[model samples]
Target: MEQTNQIERKLKLMHVVAIGLAYMSPMAVFDTFGIASDISSGHVPAAYIVVFVAILFTALSYGKLVRQFPSAGSVYTYTRNVINPYLGVIVGWVTFIAYIALPMINALLADIYLSAGFPEVPGWLWVVGLIAIITFLNIFGVKIAASVNMLLVIFQALVGVIFAYLTIRSIVKGPESFIPIGDIFPSGGEVPELFGAAALLALSFIGFDAITTLSEDTINPKKTIPKAILLVAGIGGVFFFTVTYFMQSLFPDVSIFKDIEGASPEIAVIIGGNLFLSFFLSGALFSVFASGLAAQLSASRLLYAMGRDGVLPKRFFGYLHPKFNSPVANILLIGVLSTSAIFLSLEAATSLINVGAFTAFSFVNLCVIISFFKHKGPRSFGFTVSSLLFPLIGLAFVVYLWISLDIFSIIAGLIWALLGTIYLAFTTNFFKKEPPQIAFDELEA
Candidate 1:
């Protein structure tokens, strides 16, 4: 295989950020706000604030790794290069689960929302249709995927702006005062409860790291990917904080929501009538589609990276389309897996995905610590703090969230890890040596 046969370099800073935001899906605040509000006792924004800071720390570490390695493997590449290849393989599998599960989650969400609007159509049909569309877009090329994501992200942001505007109007005209700033703090819940809520809220920020998986396909990845990572997280955090602040003001009581998942849509009706509700649903659908598309895109690249390294089968997973310069096989594989969403409940799907995401977060933080120690030299205190101290804090936060995950998620995650370990032992000839190594000198050139 040659470098020209691999993914083409076409993404810029804007395209990378657009894909990251699409993966984060600004409309996701609407999907999870009611649950977070209930958990935090009307302090949903407060929980988001906590998660935003925690994710920022981890995002900084991601910036360092992407700049150093500049490969599509993400945490897998970072861990393999800095820590150990076996651990990297494990991280790759865990990351695979996380990335693959996200698109399924989005597909399931789309199915749920579309099913409500069109009862005559089957939910499975919607899920399958979305999976097919996202797969096609991704297989076409990274540029097409980025372009589609840009349009979807713009529409979602516009919807959020309208939502914030209406929320402010309701606050000003209604009996309530506009300065309900107290609602954004954790007044009703204790620290443990607040932490739990923040952990759940952190799930909404998982997609920002998806940008790093495009290192191989990004121009000036060392510079562009890092800035895009921070921008995505920062912009997303502001969007989440502002939207949830207004939502908390409009619907202060969590008890009022008849359906937690549907709460935002219901609020849209109350504030802007049926017309706004229709627009809101449309925005939600587009956001979910964009998220799924980005998820599949990143997941396929991860698989392609592993395949190129001989960790996975090369003939299929590693193959790049000659014309499109995309991982067509891996894209179709994700599409096939996404159809399983129709058989799963949203709760079950999210729980499994959260497990993989938190596991990857914890290890990425650990990878930073390892990298810092491995490449020690005379450097400023600023370098030490950015690479070591911040990652340590992020490690603690993600470990806490990992321990706090539901029992089912913990059990399933452990099982997945166990399976990976068994496969590694067999592949490495009973732990006698490394599994395999792929020379990246040519790819890097």
Candidate 2:
């Protein structure tokens, strides 16, 4: 690839963090609060804590690997370089499921919001329109995408703060009192349910790792990318916990929400009334836009990485626009895939995401462990704990979350993995040859 046609390095730490938060969609705590609360039996905060703690370990593992292998392929690059080339191809292929499905999920959410607001307007129009706008922004350049997401993320944070304030005020004024701290914590027997809820909420934490996919686009990725990952996870975790604590405190009774999955708007109305509802809805739509933009951006980068390495058709997937220096073809392809959102439901799209998420998360941690053994490091306690113990804990949490997935997602993920294996075998001539590898030395130069 020519230098002029390559992805440009322009992102700073703030840009990376903004994109990560946008991808996570800070308002998501409101959107998933009802369902997660129901699953956790009104202990939404507890579930957030569970997921956040698990993700912290994984984030550390991601940080550890990105410093060594800071490429756009993320876990794919780490696993492939640390482990076997074939396994790396498989991990990359499976992780593609989450990357591709996330934009579709955002499209679905935008359609739902727009359709609810404009009953006379067609829903498909909203989905198509939103996808087109985001696709254009991403194709223009990653810097533009990151900038737009930064603005939208700011709006989302403002809404979260206002919603929290209103919810706190509402709780103080209402006849019902806040639940005791002890009641907010789950019992030993309820640990399974808590984990189940945490599994679902894992969808909200996708952004932290997604930031690693911008390794090539980020300035000083070895330092900036790793710090951004921790910042994203920490900021997202604190925001989610704070917002949900008030929300769970405000509405202990889930019965008030007529539709559990789509309860945030209702909660918005109760706390802030029609005016705040309008504000909340607007923010939610913007959140969807922000998320879709970042999701498509990350997905395109991953495809570019795979394509440049010949895992996919390099001519189509690896090609970057000479002027924009963006993966134009990959961005367009994801835009087309997002059109499937018009035919799919939110639950189905969400179900596809976690399968890939857990797979990538598990492998990233494994990469850290594998890399630790493959290389020689000091035998000090701190290095040993970080390199070995942390990843092991992260891997353990991933296993629990994987087991907590519903039967449908589990089966679907298995089928997806099998398909990837078949494709890998075909590409490698039934394991007779080694899989193609990304030239990090060339990329670094």
Candidate 3:
């Protein structure tokens, strides 16, 4: 067997955090608030609060796993090392679906925003252009992608803060009719319904786990990756909370939005006029573009990890540029696949993306529990809280969210899992042998 080529460690904590933030896309709170508000009956911020707690627990579990086995595969490597390799293969495929779908969704949203601004330009053109730029940067190296993501993330954060300030200013300065604090919680709803709404809001937290995929490329993966995961989740949660609070404040009535998905841009127009509207739209477009870049970068790394492990064709998916130290073929593959978003509506594309993410989230929680039992022996109180209790709580939240997924998403997710099972069966020869493994000693050293 050819020796495994290691990815150079060039990413620091901030770089990983930037990549995570870029993947989360702070401006996403604008794009998703309408659906969340509609579901929660105007309590978008409340839903985010619930989902934030859930994500925090899962992020903790992720941190634990990364400390034990720092690798590029994220959930795939964790599950394979802690559980079974066959199951790991399935997790890898599911994660691939999530990562790939995310970039496509971002690309599609970016194109939609751009087309709204310039109706003369076709949406496909924006999609192609965005994918091409991201592909080029990722193939160059992780640091280049990280630098671009940092700049974009900073710009997006500034836009979000400015929008929130303007929204609050509008409320205080405008007519007394504005209800600033009323819409943060649901007016009237069952607990289960709030949980369901929170489930949808949880999708906004998808990118934090993308940090783990950069483990091989990060400095001190054991420490930096974990800290980045928590920081990303926390920072993103605060962004969601602050922005959604102001968003609901500005547009108190969800019924007014003719198109809930585009409500953020319209809110920008209402609060800050055409200039800020232009700023908001441009910021959103750039934010989603940066997100697509981060998503593609993480997805390629995941593919490279799987390829190196012999779970996939090593010659193609596994090979990195001798100098660039990047999974060039996988980056190109994701770039090509991302353009398919031009054919898909935003709703249809986004629904499919979360299925894999939710699946991986649940499994990662389980992997943490299993690892705790295997390594820690009998659980003490501290172990139970850290390993067993927290993960179980996290799993419960994930299961609730999974059950609440749209019917089409559920059907599609099941079909994807079934396909993965078939592929696994054939690859493993009916589970008679262990899947191929790549030792990490040299890379770790």
Best by lDDT: 2
Candidate 3 lDDT, 1-445, residue by residue in tens = 3434688899998999999999988887887888777777767788889999988999999999988888899999988888988899888897688888988888888787788778999889988998999999999999999999999999998998899889889888876244445545554545556677788778888888988999999888988988999999999998898888877776667778788866777788888999999898889888888899999999999999999887888899889888788899999999998889988888778877888788889989999988877874666789879998999999999988777778988888878888988988888898887889768665562
Q: Once model 1 is optimally superposed onto the true structure by TM-score, how far is the C-alpha of residue 215 displaced, in angstroms?
A: 0.6
Error of 1 at 189 (Å): 6.2
Task: Record all residue pairs in model 3 with backbone atoms less than 3 Å apart, i.e. clashing.
Answer: none
lDDT of 1 at 314: 77
**Per-residue lDDT of 307 in model 1:** 87
Which runs in model 2 stand beyond 4 Å of their true positions? 1-5, 178-183
Q: For each candidate in the order shown, give its overall lDDT on alpha carbons.
A: 0.87, 0.89, 0.86
**TM-scores for the candidates:** 0.96, 0.96, 0.95
Q: Candidate 1 lDDT (Cα, whole model)? A: 0.87
Report each candidate's C-alpha RMSD, comma-separated, in the order given: 1.7, 1.7, 2.1
lDDT of 1 by residue, 1-445 (tens): 4545467799999999999999998898997888888877777878888999999999998998888888899988888888899999988887788888888899888888888989999888999999999998998999999999999999999999999999999988997654356545665436667777898888888777888899989998889999999999999999999999888877778788799856887889988999999999999999999999999999999999988887787788788988889988999999999889988888888887887788778878999998778775875799889888999999989888877778988788888889988987887787787856756665562
lDDT of 2 by residue, 1-445 (tens): 3644367799999999999999998888888888898888988998989889999999999999888887899988988889888899888888988988999999888888888879899989999999999999998999999999999999999998999899989999997677787887799899888888998887788899999999999998999998999999999999998999988888887878899988898988888899999999999889999999999999999999988888888888879888899999999999999899989888888888988899999999999888778767566888889999999999999998887788888888889989999998888899998967776775662
**Candidate 2, residue 199: lDDT:** 82
lDDT of 2: 0.89
Better of 2 and 3 by TM-score: 2
